[model samples]
Target: MRYAVIILALLILVVGGFAPPVVADAGADTAAGLAAPAAQTAQLGQDDSAQTTIVVNVHSDTNATWKVRTRHSLRSSEDVRAFERLVDELQRGEANSSLDEGMFRNYAELAAESTGREMEIVDVSYNGTVTDDGTTGVLTMSFTWTNFAERTDDGGLRVGDAFTTPDGGTWFPWLAEGQQLVIETPESHEVQNSFSGIREGSVVATGPMDLREQPIYVVYEATPGPEPPDPLSLELVAGVGAMLLLVVAGVLYLRQQEETVPQSDTGPASGSVVDRSPDDLDGDDPDSGDSDGGDDVDLSLLSDEERVEYLLEQRGGRMRQADIVKQTGWSDAKVSQLLSAMADEERVNKLRIGRENLISLPNESHRTNGDE
Candidate 1:
């Protein structure tokens, strides 16, 4: 339950985005009103352009580990055409965020400073769960950004649109009237982490998971950038044409390869495999259209007896569910059931390995006389 709470908080923080800001009416006047039209300011000195929006979504786990990200958007009604440098500036900033694998590293340092805590996460699971008990399942994450003033500041608080850290990357922007920009958390992830395990830190995630951009759009101000490229102009005709050509060529190549290459059907195939024959299969999804015959490794489809045999054979006498899922792309439900069955057979001992299950096999595969 503690783990669940941590995971939920993690979900909320990491699921970044912008919630719409309440635009202040232009008719509002100040205490010393003299040619001063008042709209809401992000801060005392900031202009109305500092207005921003924010959004977020969250989830949790049985194990006590989690993440939380923020997304934000900035809006202003300044004549967009006047700022021809806008596109270039945005691109440059995005490029900085990406170059040298800077995003995570930058955040890690910033977070460490913000919380006075070192940043560390273990075993970032490529796997996610939407449980049979729907209440506990994690899915459909999003974020909304409102005014920064929503959160009360007591002790020496900082405010405004440009949320910059000591690190050179300007983390957030100040916003303006009717101008809109979006930022969000990535929905999909498949990264190899140093903390997962030395023995198995190199498993490629199996499935067509989308690696998406996540943005947190709450509370920020915009810093001006270079001129935006003219959309109607023919300045980058050759560049755009080349990009399209590459995409077309890549698509054609993939189609040609897919036809010739007999690939294993991964994840939940759109249809089912009806092979009832006694041939042993490495991969056999009950709901898959195609089967590349047993070449695909699917531990979930194996019978309970087969699971025990495989665990004993590989781990000497015991095996963990993590081993199976890491080795084979079994879903979480299948992994849980498979592991429970192994425990019934007294094949492995389960232990806590950060946010995941760890299995330890017995030293001996075949027990001698009087062995339990």
Candidate 2:
């Protein structure tokens, strides 16, 4: 009986060894199934522990400076090691690393393609650091994005098209959970309108919300520039004073000229009187007949100021005062006084260029150095 029992035990042991090992394989399969979800959960937890902040500074030229900061909580040694590895990779400029310039360029290209505008990312830089207490890791990246905002016709800025997809959908994949986006305008600008965002002074903050369903849009206008300088007031005062001086000088000159001219008596002088027919006096007046009778005979009927203005009109609304004197056969002082008076009245503009003054009608443009 003992021999039979021993033989049966041997046979059972042999059968068990030759079996397909199904139980061991089943246990390994169950363990792998259980570990996979745990690993996935751990990764998701790590991702949730990260906080991201993006700051965009919009400039008046439509360019933007972008700064992205990501903070990772180092809850375990594994997280610390992973963060350090990522920092090393980024420092080495490895492809597919965290926040590399190429990835940003790709995002910018995508934005440009969706918005149908030119976009360029430049001056990309990045840094990674651990907290002093070794409890957190921080990653920072910055760049300048050209044409990030659109300039409106009314001298304002329109933002938010870059975050949209080609099909009018939001690019929410760019935003992660616990992420914040802050947009700032130039110091000289103020937010005029915001579609959906929190406004704090010139800054607009968004996120920690559902950006996928609701995108952000903002419009800002440049503040009015500084008022005209005090020198302009001084210039007005000086101009009034100069005009008064010109008027006084003109009156004194007319008085001096009148005193110089011999007064006419009731009887004509022996040499000045001549036999003249009525036809000779046709279209002639005591004030208009004094010219030497050429093309200027018609101009003689005009007042001194009118004659100067007519000469300027003939020369296409702009003439040098010296040219006016040469055209009207007037003295320099007389043309200057007339132009000064016309300028004071805003009928003409006198621009001083070098050693000469250019006279133009108020509607005419001032002459540049290249002009004659």
Candidate 3:
């Protein structure tokens, strides 16, 4: 069964014009498989219950780590052993010539020629495992492909160009049914745009998809740098300093007036005493009590969620969750719960990038890298 699957894949490659010369001497079953359509051959070679997941992590240097894992339900020990044997053969470089590193190198060379860049495939490895209850078998393979992304003029990355054929035409590698491809962005970068597939924090394409008809292109750029110091903060500090200086100067002037005043020990006459309101003494000026500035929001009047929204607005409608906690002096758990609730309410957007949650106001976009 393993040989048949390998032969089927090789036949598909031959039909697609991407086969290596080492696979030219296929058996009669290969010819028989070739008689069917390439998609049908791929579908027939795999079990209906099997699933394949391909994760491509593109690094900042344009190198990519590819991890391909296939899981199949095993009805008996023979099925597990067959999977183990296939993994062993693939690990020892004795699987089919089409499944070896040379074929990948050939693909990389063609990609390099098409993109006008140097490309190398390295660190190829394989692993196989079975569930402890022996109900399922898993086969895993991984490799690193260097220069798999093209750097843009503005210091961003343009992936998917490396998958083009040397003739500048669309070329899609074979993907079986129940297969999925996940393209992760480099660290400290956020996806800017995606030409194909669903982009929800990361790029994902689920098969059976015809890449030849709809190709994948993803663009990501580094997160924006820290914002400059808030000018409002500086203005507040200056206002406080001016108020303090005025208070000090008034105190000194009052002291000088007391020292310069002549002593008057005469007691007030019995009916000369007058009652006065504080406002009357201060001279009722309408603007005297209006100390609230346009930038100042009375946080004491706001709820916890509103306070968070206010903080996000202060920081250009986006902030890290940790920064929110720090700015609001709230506990981590409290901030997390508040943000989660706000996100559920669609009042705020929370994007988990790496270990932190980037909080943004509704309708406000945040720059972020890959998310898990």
Candidate 4:
């Protein structure tokens, strides 16, 4: 089974185009010009000293809004350290993820690349200042997207110029694959989102503007062409196909074995055999456990790194510490203390990078790097 997994992984290497454990890789130098947070960082400042802030209370009151994998929160205080592990891996000679996902970094790295452009994050408070009542908080990020084809500062490609987009990426085929759709929030905000194009293409799409995805290479995607298929989707199809083939082969082998064996005309031995059910497989949880089939228990008591790793792994790869704070409303001091403890245990490595409360998930690189 392990060998089969290894082979499948080799196939993924031949296929899955991206790096991981949590990071933005090399070739991802100057996003726009900001210094990539050399170290993964998380900082908390009591912005409004006069007001008493309550740690946000997160409850699994509603399961519909709580998806185990699709939705994620900064699950552990140690995430920043895990994030640092990825940075060290990148600094070392591990170029796997960089080579794979290098193309997309040019855009995502802007937050890390703003070298000299007066970077500022103006957050919206819930005190009803921006609106009538304090029901929402807004996060506003303004920065330069380095390769802005037409630099107003330096003369190059300007407005009214079109760039060619690519077709379905690494995985999906027929569907638009990984296409970008333009979105302008109700508040007159503008942003771009990626689309799968299968259950999520244009014709089926019935809301707002449809902009092209953030291209791996800006020079091309801005224009008109085809979008790339999702890499994960492709891998899924590949994995499924491979698994199905293996199952078929196993079935045939079993048939061959049966034919070779002398017919003993085996009958049911003795008494009735018990068949187990799904819930029976994993023993029933204690009656007092959580209601979501017992999967999500109160994990707050777990140590920082343990909590973070468990949550991120449960999700795919990434998570923001801020998001976790928002969901759980944990205090900065507590969060920091727990994460520090994890660093001491070498379960995670903490580094100062990016802005406040930023974190990343762990990957193989984290295991080898000493926590700081």
Candidate 5:
């Protein structure tokens, strides 16, 4: 059974894609110039914080795909162009590669986009639309990417844009006050691993603004296919069935043996009379030598712990420890020691009230809080 359980656990690990953990350094340098001018950042901070919303939809198929939507409200017309410039600076990376694939793959497309005077985005499909109301500017952008998620060695899927440049710089939209981000995945998938900012039921993060930090990464496992039986569950079911079958077989065999065996003589044989002696009969004779009506039984052989346990069982399995000392005439120290011993053995439970310990048997569901 032990070997079977270990084997099943190994099979689960093979089929379940366990994601490895990661630790991020907050002080790590981020990509330079990703931040719009410090003045622009300050200017936006002076006003009411604008809301930035980002949503991601992950679809599982032969090639898993992600559709991301980023919506931002700008304070002025200048901010619209500023946002555009930032978007243009995003550049792209290699197709079918992960930000976590390695340090080299992390910046392949970023390096390519950085080389030339003209801005070019690679590895992902992206487009944007902007609208201005003469006071506030609204920019909405959508990005559809393949190869966004990589399958871990353990068969888990990892998704996110948490990447650093060759020079130890990070990539992400600058967070500002009151800005919130939400990433949604399918309910069928179980999110086994995530960063600190990723919450369950859907990843959501609110911020107080940091320009240099990257987004959180999410790793999850897709629902398994139905063809192969789950080894862990199969082992459990087989163990239970075997035990139940043994119990049923033993019962049937015992019944059959009892039916085939000869019957015992439960009554007196042929003509014999069962003698009844005088001591065997009960009567109120004067010289019976019954001390105290034979009611008192010596309990000196029982230990203090045994006596306490017996008292608790006789009184509906509960009593105050103080009362036990009164009834048994044991010292406070002796009662405390006996109750503690009984508690260790789980024969009785003890709870402290105002100044005394309450003792009761385990699993007394009808027991109430008040003292009797």
Candidate 6:
């Protein structure tokens, strides 16, 4: 019996030795399975704090064009390499493997380079180091693409639909901090229906999309604004002022010359000379032109001042002195002198508002159809 037992024990030991050693390395296998994914997660966390900024410029000319500029801030050399690989994968239409293999294939080109019957990429620029030296680095890229569209029709632009990194996460992933999208349009075009409702001229701005697996879309509709008025130039104003001054000076000089000329003493030509003093002349005295022969004056014969007075009566009895100069095409000095004379003669009242003068005809002065 002892010998039979010995033989059975030997048989058991032999079977044990021949069987596979599954239990011996089970712990090692489990640890290896857990360590790989954890290491990958740790590597991704290093570069998850980077930022991205994008600028889009839309031109709605004869052909609509779109210009896109993207800037990425990277942290380490591993992050830089990861981004480079991501870009390559996107170029080959190998991105977003869970979707159709080539789903994001054309996306990078749209922001980098693309050519087709409906759209064309006119220019592209990519700058930065492939690897950062253990510190933060920057990567910048830009591309301009064009699409055929009617110039007169309203134009629209869209950006930001896909947001993902290639290395699954061990690479440079987009961060939301400082992420902004700026859209600029033509001068006469106004951007409407923007995400943020913040716009200046034709430029529109919005904050970055939240960090998520889903894509974000930004669309803008542009329409023309009212045609701008012709700009007033300093040179034109100066030229008009100089011309008015010459005209006023010439008229004054001619009047002065006429007054200085001597008159003939002999007036009777029929054979008898009627003796008369200078005061007896028909129109020599200034008092003869007055209506009441008192301080009441008549401005009917003064053509320049009369024209200004007529303008004031037409413009609700009041107008700015600068406006008067513009309306009469006269110099500022000439308008000021005429307004001062009218004010002194009590024909018009002048009120000063800040640095400007407003002139109005007197209440007693009524518009008469006879001379105006």
Query: Which candidate number would show the highest lDDT if scored against the true structure?
Result: 3
* lDDT of each residue in 5-47, candidate 6, tens digit only: 2222222112211111112242342322222222222332333
Best by TM-score: 3
Error of 4 at 88 (Å): 98
Which scores higher on lDDT, 3 or 6?
3
TM-score of each: 0.17, 0.49, 0.51, 0.18, 0.33, 0.32
RMSD (CA, Å), each prediction: 34.6, 23.4, 27.0, 40.7, 25.3, 23.6
lDDT of 5 by residue, 1-372 (tens): 322222222222122111111213323333221111234333322234234455565555313333333344566667666545444433342211111123223333443333321222233544444554644433333434344455666666676542323343444434445555565665456677665355666666665444356446677787676677789999999999999999999999988644333222212345754332332222333223344223343455455566665555545455677667655755688678878887888878887766766677775423453332
Per-residue lDDT of candidate 4, residues 175-211 (tens digit): 1222122211111111132232222211122212222
Q: What is the lDDT of candidate 1?
A: 0.32
TM-score quality measure for candidate 4: 0.18
Model 3 spans > 4 angstroms off: 1-46, 97-99, 173-176, 197-200, 227-372
Whole-model Cα lDDT of every candidate shown, in order: 0.32, 0.60, 0.65, 0.30, 0.47, 0.43
Tens digits of per-residue lDDT for model 2 on 226-289?
8877988999999999999999999999987553332322122445443333422333442232
Candidate 3 per-residue lDDT, tens place, 1-372, comes to: 433343355334323211112333354444344334433223223346767677889999999998766676777666666656666777888765233565567568767888999999999998878889988777677899999999899988889887776766544554546777899888878898885555666788876676667777899887877888899998999999999999999999987654333222111234554232342233433222334223555565667777777655544456678766656655688778878998899999887766777777765553333231
By TM-score, the better pick of 1 and 2 is: 2
User: Which window of 10 residues has the lowest lDDT sum in candidate 2?
Assistant: 13-22
Candidate 1 residue lDDT tens string, 247-322 = 9999999976543332233232346332222221224432332432234456556554464455435433333454
- Give candidate 4's whole-model lDDT: 0.30
